[model samples]
Target: MKFLLIGQGLAGTLMGFRLERAGHQVEYVDAPEQTAASAVAAGIINPITGRRFVKSWRIDELIPAARLLYTELEDFLGVSLWHPQPLIRTLYNRGDLNDWQARSADPGYSEYMEDEPATGRLPELTQPVFAYAGVRHAARVDVATMVAAFREKLIAEGRLTSGVFAYDQVPALLGADAGARNGNPAYDHIICCEGWRARFNPWFADLPHGGNKGEVLIVKTQAPLLNLMFKHRVFLVPLSDDTYWVGATSENQFSHEEPTAKNRTFLADRLAEVLTGTTYEIIDHRAAVRPTVKDRRMFLGTHPDWPQLHLFNGLGTKGASLAPCGSQWLADYLLAGKPLPEEVDIRRFNQPLR
Candidate 1:
């Protein structure tokens, strides 16, 4: 089968990889000028999250799939992509510590929660916090690098169209069972993976896409702290050497997608609070909209009215971990007539979100 994927962000990249591996031909129509959420995301896969510290949804299954796919990409692209690191988060008070201890004692949370967290350079680099807890089975993914490498490979193979793909073009592309038109090949199926931009799509716009904008900063710290990811007021993820990926202020209501001076100052202030005595120089700041859904589950499956049109989006903040397994399920359903999990199926939304 021939599949044309819209947008070459993380979702599309994974989807295309899976489809081609399953013996299908895949091409992409991407707007390189528009910033994708994947490019700006720090791509942290934390098995334990939130103040209550419950395990992420389907984390046991998600982690292995994410690790397998990223490891495969590293070999295929000849570049480093995945870096496994333990996570260390701040415990604000005695109550927080008690909660952590309780969770760690549970057999179900044994693999993800740590009884004793290893504090590497944290003590020397930052001010003393209330306490620290460790989370196992955590990792950071270089999403921007992976997507860029894949884009170059796609361009080299002539399988990519680098331009804006308007919805008006869909009819022509899908003309007469998507047969060849004017010497141009037609696709048997078209999958939309346009990230936050999917909210504007005429076909699936009613599906209640809750787009949230996030801003991040790349800074070079004076001292190196490389062992673990720290989540204080903000997440401080070590990228390489003394450089760290710091960020992310989520805004449900935003005027535009561009990075603002307010957010830059906000993130820098947060970094200062966490890093304490450490000095750092800001190298870059970026912003993009995440493809979040109201219920916080990924969107998959075909359009109710059109079988040839599909959606693989709404991975939200956990795209790095979710995309690998989610794409696999989508590919299996597309190729082998497998059923999609009811939770993620688009049909769950009877009417559009108002």
Candidate 2:
């Protein structure tokens, strides 16, 4: 089947990749000027989070699937995209350490949690903390590079159009009998992977899609910090050379998507507090709105009214680990008549979106 994908961000790119790999013809329409959150994301995949150190939802299944896909994409793209790095987070007090120990002892959590981690430069760079704990099976994905590479590939193959995709185009092309568009073959389905922007889609207007804006700063350190992903007050993820992806401030309430001076200062302050012994320069600051759902689950499935219209969104803050599996699930349901997990299916909403 042929598919028309809107937005070439992480979600759309991965979804398109999955479909094309399944022997379906896929095309993308994206506004290159729009700010995609995936472009600025740190792409840190942490298996454990929160003060209680609970495991991420469906992490065991999510990780293996993610590793398999990313590894496969690396071979297909001929680029190194996955970085297997451990994560070390500071423990603020005795209470935090005890919680970590308890979580680490659980059979389900043992493989992901480590009581002792190699500190490397953390001891020299950061202020004194109660302790530090390591997390295993963590990695950093170069989402920006991946998306950019895929965009180029799409352009080269004439599969992508670089322009804003107007929503009004949906209704005219919603069925198998729909006429060809712009002299191109009619698409079997029009999938919305537009991220935070999907809230504005008229067809899925009642799905309760939400957006959270995040700001991140890219800094170049005079000396190298720890190679592992580190979390102190905020996340400090290592990138290429002496640069690091430092950020981000999450704002559920925001008037605009531009990078603010307040958030930049806040992130810079935290970096200074953590990288105590080194000097660094803030090279860039960027912000984008992440597609969010009230229940913290991704949105997937066909529209209640128009069967040819579908949505694959709501990966939220964990897009790195979530997109691979989420896209695969969407593709499986689309291609093989498989059932979508109730938690993610759009039909979970009782009332049909008007």
Candidate 3:
């Protein structure tokens, strides 16, 4: 089958790769600047979260898939993108420590959680009363580099087009059963992976998209680059060249995608709380809206009315971990006669377009 994948962000890029690998032809159309949440994201895949010591949803399935996919990408692209770093989760108080201890005792948490407490402290951070715990098998992906490399390869193969996709022209361009031609080629399916912009897509606009805007800051510190990710109220991820990625506020109510002074101040204040006695220079600030959903589940599957149209989006904050597995599942469903997991199928809405 031939496919036209819209929006070459993380979701679309991964999906296109999967479909192509599964013996299908794919062409991508995307405007990178407008849909850049994946590029700006910190891309950390830590399995444990929250002060209450809860494990992330479906982390067991998500992590292994990520490890396999990123490792494969590294070899395929001849570039390094995966960093298997541990996470240092500092305890806020006695309750937080107790919660960690209890969660650690559970056998299921063995793979992601450490049973022992962290021994040392960073000279830059104030010592917590109960110290910190480590979450192993945590990792970060270089999203920007990965996406750029893949897109460049696609462009070289003449399989990608860089431009704004005019939604109104979609049906006219791709309405026939024999498929519609764009210049020289015809496509059998059109998959929408428009990220937060899906809210404006007429076919998918009513799918309960509760998008959230997130702002992130890139800062450089003189301190030696740490090998692990650190977290308290906010995350501090170490990057190349003694730089760190700090972020991100989940603001459901926002005016635009531009970074605001208010969010800058908030991130600065939070950074000061966790990283003390460390002098850092602000390198860059970026903001993008994520395709979050009201139910916090991804949107996958064909449109109820248009069988040739499909959607693969709403991985949201967990896109780094979710995209690998989600894309494969979508490809399987499209290429084979597999059914989409009920939790992520768009058909769950039970409403068709008018």
Candidate 4:
């Protein structure tokens, strides 16, 4: 079967990899500068979140498969992208500490959450941190390297187009009986994975795509606080020896995805207020809009009127964690004619968000 994937972000990359591995021919069209959310994202995949230290949405089912996925890709690309580092989650005050204790009492919570403290030569945090640090099993992938590797892999095999592609350039699917890529017609079974750019895709653009403009900073923090990616609304991911990624503000109604000095200052101020760390220098700054929905569930499944057409975006903040499982399910449904899991089914929008 011939599949046409729009953007080469995480979702598109994983889904396309699955399809291509299944012997389906895939030719992706990507506008790199315009569609590089994977490059800017601090792709941490911790299973615990929030002040209460609750488990992430689907950590149990997805966690096991995630390591294998990234490891396989890393070996294939010859670059280590995925990281299994601990996260030091600090408790700001008394109330937050109590909530963490109460939640930890539950068996469901204890497996993934803990009340450990910061150890080793780590700098003293202003607030006492009851850290739930662990190997987390999940790792942060170097999104840009993996994207470039896959893009090159696909292109070298004559499966990629490196140019801006307008929607009309996509030919329709050959017919219902056609295979995914090489076996059948492509124009018919197009799945739009354009990220925020999906708004411009004539076919799936009408779907509700609330935009979140996120700004991230690439900084050189000579302080080698390695072994984990730190997160507390803002993330300080260790990039190379002397680098860390401090990011991300969820701003709405932005005119463009370009980085703004105002947001850069805002991100710096936010990180500074949290931790008293070593002096840092901003190396690069970028911003991109995530194609999100009001409910935060991704838009995945065939279009209402066109079963052959599909959509995959809106992992929101958890694209790193969710895209692996979500894209696998999408590939399964697409190849085996199985139903999409209820969580991400596009038709479920008609049902009120619980």
Candidate 5:
């Protein structure tokens, strides 16, 4: 079957690859002005989350699937993108240390937690009054490179069109026989992966999209190169050379997508608390809106009224880990006859949306 994919962000890119691999043709249409959260994302996949240190939702399923998918894509793209790095979580206080020990004893955290706290791992870093713990099987993906390479490859293969997708033209363009093969290219279905911009999409505008603006910084630090991700409040992920991706300030309420001075100061103040011996220079700053849902779950499945229209978005901040499995599931449902898991299906919203 031939498919038309709107937006070449992480979700659409992954889904397009899956559909093509499954013996289907995919054509992509994306707007140049679209703010893709995937481009600026840190792509860090952490199993444990929050101050309470509870495991992420369905992390067991998400992490393993992510490992397999990224490893495969690494070989396919012939680029080094996926890096499995340990995460060193700093213990802020005695209470934090106690909670870590308690959770470590639980069998559920066996695969994710370290056997002991890494107290002396970084002597240079300010001696935490409490302690530090290591998380295993944590990793990062070079999302920006992956997205650019995929987009370029699609464009080269005559599968991508670069321009704004006028929604009004869609109905007239796809008239009569949905899959009819004519001189002009026609698609059997059009899947919307328009990220945060989906809130403006007439078809999916009603899906309760609560877009959050996130800001991150790329900095060159004099600190010694480390293979593990350092996290306290803000995460410092090592890239190549002496540069690291430092950031992510989550502002649920923001005026625009532009980087703000307030967030920059916030990140710098927090980063200073973690890096005692390291001198760093800010190299780049970026901001984008994450396609977060009000309920904090992914939005998936076809339009309620339009059978030929589908949506596969709302992976939010966890796009790297979520997209791998989510895209494959969407492809399977589209190509095969599998039913979408109830949790992610858009049908859960019973009220009419404006």
Candidate 6:
């Protein structure tokens, strides 16, 4: 089927790639006037999170698919975008280490923790330091690189149109007689993947969403952290561009305004505590809201009124690990006439939307 995809962010890009690979033509419309949260994202994929250190939702099913997608796309684009790195989660205090040890005894953490040794190389803050291994299989994707690669292919295939999509322009239903859009009219169906802006989308305003804004920074470090991406309160991702990413602050309180100096300074100060002598340059600062569901689950599946008008969003803070699988699922459902798993279906919520 010929599909019209609004937005060229991670969700839309991946879905477009999947449909095209399945021999369905896809037309992607994403102008610079668009709001792309995927562009500003740090793209760190961690399977375990929080002080309790529990598994992420559906990590088992999600991680493998995401890796496969990255590999396939990297080969297709002739670019090295996915990085497998170590995640060193330092224990700020012995209490933190003790808490981790207790949690490690649970089967939930067995796969993620390899070693918990005393790495004295860290800062000797008031909180005693203990070194612990994080999910080494954790991955990071270069959002800019991946987006460029996908967008390049879309451009080459003549599937990309540069411009923002107003709510009214998106047809709310698929016409019955429409075949693949390449012949005459543009598309058989339209899937909106505009991230947090989905709140404003009349097509999906009823889909329960609690917009979540996050801020991130790119810093030029003298040398790579190379020790997997480190995390305490903040994350540090190494880039081929000789920069490290430190972020982020998940704020439900703020607007989707420009990245503020306040957030940059906050991240920088936190980063300084971790780096001993590495001089860094503050290269860039950015912010965007994740298309979060109020319940914190991914939002997918078709519209209540128009099944052909689908949606794929709500990755929240974990878009790197979530988008690939979510996109694939959406594409499979669209092309092969499969069902969207119940958990992510927007119908699960009760709302006319407040």
Task: Report clashes for each candidate as comma-separated counts.
Answer: 0, 0, 0, 12, 0, 2
lDDT of 6 by residue, 195-292 (tens): 88778788777777777777888888665535457786788777765687788887887854578878888888887777655577888888877778
Q: Cα deviation in Å at residue 190, candidate 5?
A: 0.5
lDDT of 1 by residue, 81-150 (tens): 9999989999989999999998877767988887668888888788798898888999999999999999
Per-residue lDDT value at 148 in model 1: 96
Q: Between prediction 1 and prediction 3, which has the larger TM-score?
A: 1
Candidates ranked by lDDT: 1, 2, 3, 5, 6, 4
Candidate 6 C-alpha RMSD relative to the actual structure: 3.8
Candidate 2 C-alpha error for residue 247, in Å: 1.3
State in Å the error of residue 73, model 4.
1.1
Give the Cα error of residue 29 in candidate 3, in Å.
0.9
- Candidate 4 wrongly placed segments (more than 4 Å): 125-138, 169-188, 274-277, 350-354
| After superposition, candidate 1 runs with Cα above 4 Å error | 177-185, 351-354
Which model is ahead, 1 or 6, in terms of TM-score?
1
Q: Is candidate 5 or candidate 6 better by lDDT?
A: 5
TM match of model 2 to true structure: 0.95
Q: Which window of ten consecutive residues has the lowest lDDT sum in model 5?
A: 176-185
Q: Pairing residues by index, what is the TM-score of model 3?
A: 0.93
What lDDT score goes with residue 37 in model 2?
Answer: 93
Q: Model 2, which residues run further than 4 Å from truth?
A: 175-185, 351-354
TM-score, structure 6 vs. true: 0.89
Evaluate model 4: give its TM-score.
Answer: 0.89
Indicate which candidate wins on lDDT: 1
